[model samples]
Target: MTANPLADDITQAAACLGGDGLLAGEVQGFAARPQQQEMAAAVEQALTDASTLIVEAGTGTGKTYAYLVPALLSGKKIIISTGTRHLQDQLFHRDLPTVRSALGVPLKAALLKGRANYLCHQRLHMTRSEGRLGDRRQANQLEQVFDWSGRTASGDIAELSNIPEDAFIWPRVTSTTENCLGSECDWFSDCHVMKARREAQDADLVVINHHLLCADMALKEEGFGELLPGAEAFIIDEAHQLPETASRFFGMALSSRQLLELAQDAINEYVGETGELDGLPDVARELEKATREFRLEMGQGEQRAPWSRLDGNPALTEAREALKTALADLAIQLEPLSERSRGLDNCYQRALRVQTLLAQTTEQPPADYIHWFETWRQSFRINLTPLDVSENFNSQRHALPDCWVFTSATLSVNDSFSHFAHKLGLEDATTLQLDSPFDYANNALFYVPKGMPEPSSPDYTRHMLDETEAIIEAARGRTFVLFTSYRAMNLARERLRDSCQFPLLVQGDAPRNELLERFRELGNAVLLGTSSFWEGVDVRGEALSCVIIDKLPFASPGDPVWQARIDAMKEGGGNPFMDEQLPHAVITLKQGVGRLIRDMNDRGVLVICDPRLLGKRYGRVFLNSLPDMGRTRDLDDVVKFFHASDALSL
Candidate 1:
């Protein structure tokens, strides 16, 4: 009788993980962790049993491999989705190869990004034929991409190392669903997007981010969007972000950029398909002019309004009517060539979508949705955002595979998965909670200054800066002063610049990756950042010793969608503040605190200046949710701890 080979392989893989592992004999600095092994076993079981598992493995738990090992060993095809592209690129390019080598499994894997990430050869050719862009910089950048386009095999814009991600030229060279001519394009034979999709469809494991997964699920009717139809299992790492990201996918939005882009494409396609009819350019100009007038009336820089405010404006009404009239005329002109060219068909389809969205914005939304308008400098967008995505999200069982696993360190609030489970509509899933293996008692201190002003107080920022001085000095500037708002961050940047000798790195000084790299090299720099810095950021050692949070991470009440949801909850006799807001803030705060104490040997100070955590009744939620560490009120204890660490280092 032959024993099961997978059983031995699993055991061998487990053994090879830490000090006793086979790799340890060949490599240096490997220590076996019981948490990793335990998690791997649980993951294996979850995959085998076809059960939904929500596991919270804390920092230093070796979570990536914990799930990846079981996923690789299952032999069943799985789609592992992460919250960020950096993690997606890491797993597909780095981590998966190492795991496959360790386990000796040759399972196939591929990385799939959205269509916009790939360069469209047809679009590049079209841009070149259209002549130089007005600006010298724009024309030069276009020429640079033209040269690089010939050399890039993958056609990934990310490979353009010299260019910034926000480069204006990327939009002109990349393909969007609205402008892509599909099989009718001349470059169809060598399309990068189609080739990537072929790899994804053929591989046993497909690595994707949350946005792509949501798109695949949302756009199932499109043939290429059927990326998940054949997979046997699903694993969503960083499951806490899934619910929020899912909302954006489930919602409907029509931006003025979409309108203008469609208008521009209509003009170009009309010329390509039929050599420029007399009225074609005029039709496109009318649409663009309407958008400009609409935006002019909307006012700008950043503002959100309920549908009533936008709909009530006479200029906006006149602009929408003018846009509708222009689109109707454009459709009439393009009707003759729509059958001859897929490009014209695509433009007509976009026109239809724009018309439908324009008409729908004036109508009352369904009871479960909130209709709102937002404005930026160049565009005004109307959105039919879902107030409650649970029902819509839960109805996606048809889109998912049988085996499901959702894992993250911050999924649970107050040591239970109720909040995450309820938010994501995953009620009956099996739950597991694993605390961090770090000795936080000895390695970390939680400092809340005594007699701090409340967050709502006008003097809060000034007072918080006063409290921050001691801790910043104690850690000797290895600090991340995280803020809930740009207002707080800017204020801190202003006050702290004069108050301290330590160099300060503000969020917008450079890109996030550049800033993080600079922070590590600077050694004693105090980095002030908000939202994006809180999660998916890892800095090991004393480089990031302290994390100071300005306030609880509550969603702004002024947010149209948030306010609508809050109103709905109130009407239904639920406390939106307690049920929805608190749990969310707890999870977010956990992510911010997580930046400190990243690895087993790392040490840091966590100073939260928000008085709500001490003065309010709901503060207990935060206190209970955070990792248990040594607590302090006096500044001397922090200084002494730093002194002791410095002495030990000497």
Candidate 2:
């Protein structure tokens, strides 16, 4: 095989794999899709050329290999960053190994997760001695972990999935930088995180999540030494999420649930009953009740009413004061409990967090910070976040000067990268977009249901649900009804549950992966979900033939983080909607639409039940962001499109 000279010279040092490399495919049997080959060439050029690269390789472009081959062959110590832990694992375990074997080289690679994944020996010892395992299930899991610790080489909690990820027991086992005893710990000499870092430092390629990458960019002394390690480049997969994740890391947030958890944990440690807080449960219950009452009083009868400030209602004022006093009393009780139980450290820490949150909520925040209260289900929450992430992003970029490459299936809007570029402070960076190999017009129909009201109208939700039901019926059970809000998702799920012939799957019914597994397994299933499902879902083939998006995903104006950002933009004389919200929605809509076509042969219908896409001028921006599917309004046409593709496939 003739290697492209534009490819890295390290390709000459290739070593063939001796085994199957743990995947079903052959090690040397990899074939690059045309777009992937082009992207790989471009990335190779970017390294040689020392240019910042931004490429959008839509789904099935095989982007991971396109960048990985160049990165591995570059002989450059490179960091491959992803948006989620799942992707991080996929690259490290599946993709990297396959690529390395195909290249026929002894290239070294390391998968570094966040600090939270590594076991904290000190915490583990403390919690074990204190018998703070909480539940019987956790105790059993801990017993297995203890046994596994002796024989396991890498102390990654991910290695043990039998234990639920949300099991609080992991916190007892894992160590954060805050809680790590560092050099003083008994496990310091054998620290798994340190070992991983050392391996990463010596390896040709390092795989990491964006959170860890951003932590290295933001925090001074994070365990993972400098992010790039004087590497030739950094390739960020799932790059569309970079801006939002960056915003989160660059900003600050303190939630009440965190505080309440802390208080309850402290009580658990003191009472030696690790189930729930002893005397404090009643107090916590009353606090929740009071908070709900306050919200009700403030909202009157309007469920969707927004709160501008915290000073209007006398009842709200009284509730706030009472809640604060109760929490303070709870905090004092927790202090003693925390002192008695080192296992209660997280609990005590959370209590202090709650106290700080309460204090912050009552005070006047800086102009840079946006503060707001959210009422959900039976609880209320106060939030504070930064107004603009551009400044912070710019600072980070200037601080770290390695060649940064951001790639995703949906980063650009209508061939323009302006929205994403601005958000990521990519003013001086190189940008490229690689269209998916999938034939969208041939395989997919863009169904903009006609005569629907604007999304802003009160009747929009019901109308959108009705339209979605029609499309689902036409597609005959292979559908994804994606909504922007939980209320809408629930309503649609409830309305269609009895009427729909197929098995209905909702988001919260299980973990995302499990839900997806079931969706694919069921074959004819109607899955209704919200934001998280919009992106990262890969349901190719006949399982997912229809996708219904309720509306263009605009950031809620009442969202505390968004309101702060809008206010900040206003102060700077910029249109917040244009600069921030529209682009965000466009990127998100791209993700939702991209879900439809997974392979060149896969056929589906993307039904936008919201009329705003046609009614409003900004809607074109979203329409243009999607793959060029033939548009249709007639229900018969959509059904015809699906059946036509199915026939062609047969």
Each prediction's Cα lDDT score? 0.83, 0.73
Question: Which portions of model 1 show Cα errors greater than 4 Å?
Answer: 1-18, 22-28, 132-134, 220-224, 274-278
TM-score for candidate 2: 0.82
**Candidate 2's residue-wise lDDT over 227-246, tens digit each?**
55556678899998887777
lDDT tens digits, residues 560-638, model 1? 8888889998999999998888999999999999999987888888898887898899999899988899999888988
Clashing pairs in 1: 16-21
Judged by whole-model lDDT over C-alpha atoms, candidate 2 comes out at 0.73
Candidate 2: misplaced stretches above 4 Å? Answer: 1-32, 220-222, 227-229, 255-308, 311-364, 372-384
